[model samples]
Target: MLSPNLLAWSVELFIKEPGSNKTVFWHQDITYWGMGETDDEVTAWIALSDVSVKAGCMRFIPGSHKGGIVDHEDTFSADNLLSRGQEIGGIDESQAVHSPLKPGEMSLHHGRCFHASGANRSDDRRIGLAIRYVTPEVCDQAPGRDWAMPLRGEAPAGGWSCIAGPRGLFHAADLALYDSIIEGQTATLAAGAEQDVSMYGGTKA
Candidate 1:
């Protein structure tokens, strides 16, 4: 659920294979997002499979959203699922709250919440869908421009342009648009850097 002024910004599926060691590092969603100034964004993480601590369920630092953005370091580990393997510093793991959920269940968190997931140690795979919602008042701050779909209310003008929904999977026009968008996103995420540090707007660790 989102404010009336907000729209669906993006959606992504994250999967952790059974017995995989890949992990999502501790970091705030806003840090990697282009959403500017206003942290008027929320993420709905919907579980597609039975998820638990052993299956790498998400963990959050309660009330951590109020602290604002903090410093992060790129671990560059092969098992890190983050774009840059970015991890927030000085975290007290003892304060973390593990969030386990059944299929179809979901958890909502502010964009600035500190969160992460451990390596999956279960016998079954774990899948989660993360849907991000952002208010039109938020500005895109990444290198390349960004686009968002209007899910509710009138779509905002400027900053992001409107895009038509794909009529079918792998449609020619859709594929072209997808390629163009991916190019822009890759450039924006790369930020002209040669390594994973490019994703971080601050000094590399």
Candidate 2:
């Protein structure tokens, strides 16, 4: 089990075309997330295609999560995969570990872990699915309401409201809910109260 207090949050998909120079700068996932208090979050990175160092597989600094959230700056570079192109300064790349994966393999990392990926230098496309799970006890620090899907065990109250599954694709009711949620997210992130909050834009990958 990931954690008794944790619950699944969100998932994101990332695609890198062949010879793409785009890179994910060294950073911590918790830097931009709204999850409050607890850092008990995990991300499952599943590769849709064979990912090697040449294809820009993820790299990590072992035991980095123990250091908690580190400082990050928005590079806003067009070649960065992050929404705001945020990058952590003073990362010792010499201590990094390259993580290569087969098509069906997956790797798990803590939300606070320091990680990043290089530009795709291979001849084939690289795709990855990142599913994030967080503790329900964690509250959204950003202003505005939040929602989450309950996966298992006793659901916790407060922080995130539960939403029902959509009956069909592009269903009217579902679309309305989505639009409302997106609007709320936009407002929350646009407050610009802090560097991390301001840097929160779209999916990092």
Candidate 3:
């Protein structure tokens, strides 16, 4: 059974505009996350708008997580949504399972699951909020500091910096804090990458 007590590692709001060619290539969430092969993390992808197959809903490979982390190629394609366009080659597409969700509905997947989303062909935007949760035991192995916000039960004792809730909507202090977190995390995500990480724009020396 999954634990009810969890900390929010991160929350990302994805908006794929109508008729957008942006494609999320076949990849695993575990890549470049520095968590190793731990199973303590889960991603709750909540659909803010109707996410249909035509709207580029995410697809998963059944039992792919059992293979653990494998080699990934960084293509850095212009239409790819990933930071590095990291992809796992030789995936049998015929075995993929598409996951479509209605507004307010959510789908959960392990961090190691191989997943990808296609281009949005629908007329409406495909919006979703993905919240990554991790148990207290999960710790970052990448460089620099890491953090998680405690959402339920006792907070973690160490290894992660516990972030506080935002003070106000678009507050200056809160915005600054948000920028700091992104800047710090960019380094960890871009570690060992070939081309400079374009996530923050401008090349990193």
Q: Which regions of candidate 3 are displaced past 4 Å?
A: 142-144, 199-205
Model 2 residue 28 CA deviation (Å) reads: 0.5
**At residue 33, what lDDT does model 3 achieve?**
78
38-131: candidate 2 lDDT, tens digit per residue? 5667889999998999999999999998886777887777777776677899989999999999998999998888999998899998888888
Model 3 CA lDDT for position 174: 80
Off by over 4 Å in 1: 142-144, 192-205
- Residue 124 lDDT (model 3): 96
Q: Which TM-score value belongs to model 1?
A: 0.89
Error of 2 at 198 (Å): 11
TM-score, each model? 0.89, 0.87, 0.93
Candidate achieving higher TM-score, 2 or 3: 3
What is the Å distance of residue 145 in model 3 from its true position? 0.2
Q: Write the per-residue lDDT of candidate 1 for residues 2-75, one digit (tens) a residue.
A: 56866776777778888988788888877756564366788899999999999999999999988768877766
**lDDT by residue for model 3 (110-196), tens:** 878999999889999898888989988887884238878988987888767888898988999989877877776777778899887
Error of 2 at 55 (Å): 0.9
